[model samples]
Target: MSAPYAIPRSHADWRAMAESQSFETRAFIDDAFVDAASGETFETINPATGKVLARVASCDAADAEVAVHHARAAFDRGDWSRIAPGRRKKLLLRLADLMETHKHELALLDTLDMGKPVSSSLGDMAGAIACLRYNAESIDKVYGEVAPTGEDSLGLVLREPLGVVASIVPWNFPLMMTAWKIAPALAAGNSVILKPSEKSPLSALRLAQLAKEAGLPQGVFQVLPGFGHTVGKALALSMDVNCLAFTGSTAVGKQLMQYAGQSNLKRVYLECGGKSPNIVFADCKDLDAVAENAAAAIFHNQGEVCIAGSRLLVENAIREDFIERVLKAAEGMQPGDPLNPDSFMGAIVDQTQYQRILGYIRQGVEEGAHLRSGGESVETCPGGLFISPTIFDNVTPEMVIGREEVFGPVLSVFGFDTEEEAIRMANDSLYGLAAGLWSQDIDRIMRVTRRLESGQVYVNNWAGGDMTVPFGGVKQSGNGRDKSMHSLQEYSELKTVWMSLTS
Candidate 1:
């Protein structure tokens, strides 16, 4: 499982690869790639160039029904669902191996498709391979429970897979997020249908072909690429789909819940929006280190992360010094060509997001939040949807920029006088996916961490964790975790089997 692809050393190397890249842009159903039912195709644009890379099958409700039909047949036939765990594990491992083998191609596709820097795309691919391998290895290790009972009776608690799972992933971190949902769902022995975001569906489609090559049974794993309203809604409302796992906005998450409720009451697992707060206290041993981490928290991946630490809450004791340090760190993260090896940041996903992020920047200014550093687009990468890393100081909890999930590289800084005030400001948002705390005081760290309303908290750090930790949120951030053993539970059902020994 060592790194399978050699890292491209130059922008020319990456550009050559992107120019020659051949994408699989059709709906993969029942182990075959086919055209949409209506013969309609949508352009998969390169956000960095605003050019059409390929014409992908624009699947609709009819296509969803066909794929679901195949998935249901495969599940009912026990081709994958009832297979031995070891066999399933082997298949998934082979798929992971195939993914590793094609890591470079996948990385290039993601970069050209979504505008993330090539290095970031490669990093995401590595994480994706690890996540898949971890879930595959866990498939054979998990054991059912033997419930205690009197000698006259025997009770067993069994974990069984839900029939068919539909995973709707987001555009940001596309490959990684797809791995988060599909790995666990497939490991749990469920037939999975991945409905990746239309904005970036190239990697998912390629992975489907790899899954087929890995010898997964027909219809066991399918990729239906289309818009959420038609294909996503159809899958959510499908009577055959037993569980629906989604990672996207809170509004869309809510719509999926409604779809679930209106149809078959399918189990819905969502990892939605986050306006995560990074609280820095004066007791922090190193302001410089904290400032570096704070900058990376929001600027990495062009700040298109769902659990990004977009809110910066600083204790007033060292507010001026720390803010200055953070601004300095941000200065080095201007957007550039995604293919360039040295580019720290890349373009926004698309024109819509580009304009949306710009709108937020304008709103922040109009609402009186001081534009400290970057607040506009950068011309360094021509034709790319590149926005400069933006920071807004003097932000209030009441402001829209502070309250909403911008999903861009927009950092909103707020000043606080005490630990209580920092905690209050951090928890005032509607979302609670993740939060960060920087302090050397052990007692205050523990006390403040206990009060922060987030699923994952990083102390003295911004974001650094492996796939072993659970990732999810509270309140409006959505429910159910995505990684680790907890995600396995999301795709499985527990049942009790009681037997009378006396009989």
Candidate 2:
């Protein structure tokens, strides 16, 4: 049965109803939600309406140590790690079922905490469920290998799970990202200590409860909600943590790598930032579709995606027409309360991010780029963190707005005269997370796909994929993949067994 809170209505109705709702205090540890050790708490505000949704526990390094100790004890005792693979798989599948049952509540919590539109949060919740299920289904299927050897000798390769994993998930798509890391880690027989982003920790806390209800053993899945400087640093530096996975900015990813090296030399997997390119060729069949997709690519989730196609590389022949269409589409993107299912774009994550995006917009104009559509901050609601959908034409590849990740609804479009120039410009960024190509010609598609230096490439679309496909990046965009059987391998180590009959 669907959750009672899951209502069917237009975006407008959802927005109006959600604005009046109040949330409870949040903290999850050892299979229960509790207050911080220091008795300190913080408020999580809705950026769309600037209202406090929940008061969450504010933890520090001391709390992190407690969480880690529990995780280490659980792993050392082998309650989860020594469980049969088939049994572990069943537990994971049960968790997935529970997530489906409470989809509406989880989706609503996500929207209220992160300020993403309810529709988008619903989709994200669905994706998170799929991720957990996919990993669960693959748990028992992964097999060790036996290498061919001479007579009277045997050799076998085995995969073993790391003891305890520390997962640091970003604010954008908080629950989904956490599942991307935790599902596979747990399926592969590891205990996890998750540190959700301070900006949005409600869903993670709720997820801990759901996991417990779904039969996850105590300490097998623990959540430590706190600021990154203390709790995050503590997790990274803890010698007991066998593996560390993170999804955030490139700058922070580098820092985590350094911390990992300094501590236990633990295996680190990072999925970092990107300034992805969405290249549109003149030979594309539909300019209107390209323009619409371009707008959606940058504006979806308020442009908070690590793999957002913020850099638009267009052919000079149809550049003016394409920009006009893109601007028209941008104007139609209504930014309002996130609980509204009708609003495609919601508020920025917080006031700081709102001002940061505005600063970038102003910098683009000061750097001589043309403001094609929207740039200034929206004054609606007076306190909510909202920015108008912004598009910049006449932008160069070297502009700050073009190169750096604004992490808001900002698009920078650059024109190139030839295909060679277009590909060159598209590949001219330190980030190589994702890129898109719009072309009908088979040869052009193949050639561009081969030349473009990105981890994931899409043709005539943006951000559509199943859990089987790998997701990661190269260069400064960071290393490692998530959301596949490959992701489970990241949490495991390989061992070889050799036997000799000569003895």
Q: Supply every candidate's count of residue pairs whose N, Cα or C atoms clash at under 3 angstroms.
A: 0, 2
1-503: candidate 1 lDDT, tens digit per residue: 56544556799988877877788999999999999999998888888888889999999999999999999999999978998999999999999999988898898888988999999988998999999999999988888999889999889999999989999999989999999999999999899999999999999999998898899999999999999998999999998899999999999999999999999999999999999999888888878888999999999999999888999999888988999999999888888899997898998999999999999999999999999988888776667788888999999989999999999999999999987788888899889999998888899989998999998999988777898999999999999898898887778899999999995
Regions more than 4 Å wrong, model 1: 1-7
All models, RMSD in angstroms: 1.4, 1.6
Candidate 2 C-alpha lDDT tens digits along 1-503: 56546464776556555655545455566777777888888788888778787778888888888888888888888878988899998999988988898787788778888889888998999899999999999989999998999989999999988999999999989899999999999999999999999899888877887888889888999888888888899999999999999999999999999999999999999999999999998898888878999999999999999988899998899989999999988887858667677778888998888888989999999999998788977765557787888999999977899889999999999999988998889999999999999998889999999998999999889987899899999999888999888898998989999999786
Clashing pairs in 2: 11-341, 11-342
Give the TM-scores of the predictions, in the order they appear.
0.98, 0.97
